[model samples]
Target: MSSRFRHAALVGKYQARGIQGPLEEIAQFLVRQGLDVSLERDTALNTGITDYNALTHAEMGRECDIAIVVGGDGTMLGSARQLAQFGLPLVGINQGRLGFITDVPIGHFADALAPMIAGDYEEERRTMLEGGVWRDERLIFDGFGVNDVVVSRGPTSSMIELKVTIGDEFVGNFRADGLIVASPTGSTAYALSAGGPILHPGIAAWVMAPIAPHDLSNRPIVLPDVGRISIEVAQGRDASVNFDMQGMASLLPGDRITVARSSHQVRFLHPLGWSYYATLRRKLHWNTGV
Candidate 1:
């Protein structure tokens, strides 16, 4: 069978001596296979590979048919946000400590590259959340969260109040350290640490977890990923709504944010024999009941 992807781009942690070997290996592998290959600017500079073409992040997204991300999940998260709009497919080679989204092992990935290029792989379409904040009818914060969108206190180090509504239904006024609206992809992230359930990535759902609620009775809830989630913060103190801990926007009393499933989704490619259960077992230590 012929290769499914022609132009490929390599994006990795922007450091030398760390990913240089694997980066150069994959670049040369694709080159010998006759598939066009390029590198993200920092990846090229850090790896000291002068022969292949280099593209800026934007250029890479617009140009490449596939992006082979060679870092931890953080690298993939950043890339996913940038390329999700372009609808680019990402294949990860785990160089991170915890490989949730970045699953493919380094040595194993090198071997699978050829077959993956030949269209022998599985594609996972993961859902994303799009959120925007409104201040007196003016839009302020606009961004996408792959994991969770949080509304919480800033430098004050005290609890804040948030009035929440889910699809016209009033949930409650939450008084807590913070609140996290986690996508199923986010269930394993902050939401999980906050005592929230892990919804399977394939499931279409969101989890609303309160971070240290003043009332123990206030609990996390899983809701369908439909309609809009509205959160209005109470006034008199400093607060912000954080997106993936990557972006944040200040909020005032009565300012609100509405989060909904984005129309766009991120496509992740895995080599033929990928298993989510295995990943969870390895990452979370499933069987060792200590």
Candidate 2:
């Protein structure tokens, strides 16, 4: 379905390592297009663009017809969880090293946006995972992650032993630095670093990879999105559950966390001429030497 509002919401991290310059340019360019632009309050204040409307991250999803993110994939992933269920399509401008989600570069920002504004873009639906933490039968934290939910030992702790079960079947006990339950969109992030396979974004599966496992036989495993995953800290000095690197909750010696496919999905806007493989090649320096 087409959008109903002409207004667009702008979200980004101008404070990222090397992003301020391009962010300023994009913000100014959006204003020059005669479009009604909305910005996060802090961003609006930092950039000194007072005339624009201010909205919280989630509120922006409700107010704007489309949302534009001006940072790298991490920034986009964070914003996507907040805006995904709103059914607002996201346009990401690459301002960091790996532009997986933010595929549009600074040079082509204008060209890409013009067509997008006119509704000439493709929408790709990406999966998300929802997790909940329980302690003493009390619900502690519940949230969704676009990428992965990681359960790891805290600082100064040895490797953790975690018991994993899927659909009432015992998976196995994992003895590792941590465990990563990643969506297809996240296979290239921490999971890839731990030797997990890169999953195509359109795939409807998740990967469970044990980080720095004590046993080499514990390899990464792919699971269908329909099943439920239960992970308990069978034994550990100290451990924690992290959601997309944003939210964290403490895990005592015997805490268990359950992860399942979220009913909500994130929609990404891919303007004409954008290619995911091209992004991988560029970011990874695949052909730099040749």
* Candidate 2 RMSD to the correct structure: 2.1
Please give the RMSD to the true structure for each candidate, in Å.
Answer: 2.1, 2.1
Model 1 TM-score (2 dp): 0.93
Each model's lDDT: 0.87, 0.84
Give the distance in Å from residue 150's predicted Cα in candidate 1 to where it truly belongs.
Answer: 1.3
Candidate 2: regions farther than 4 A off: 1-5, 17-24, 288-290
Q: What TM-score does model 2 achieve against the real structure?
A: 0.93
Model 1 accuracy (lDDT, Cα): 0.87
**Each prediction's TM-score versus the true structure:** 0.93, 0.93
Model 2 lDDT per residue over 186-283, tens place: 89899999899989888899999999999999999989988789998888976888878876645886678889999999989988766778767887
The residue pairs that clash in candidate 2, if any, are: none
Error of 1 at 174 (Å): 0.3
Residue pairs in clash, model 1: none
Model 1, range 1-290, lDDT digits (tens) per residue? Answer: 33489899989887524678788888888888778999988878777877889998789878888999998887888888888888889999888889899998887776878888878888889999999899999998888988889988877657888999988898889899889999988899999999999999889999999999999999999999999999998743678887787766467888998999999899999888888898899899986885
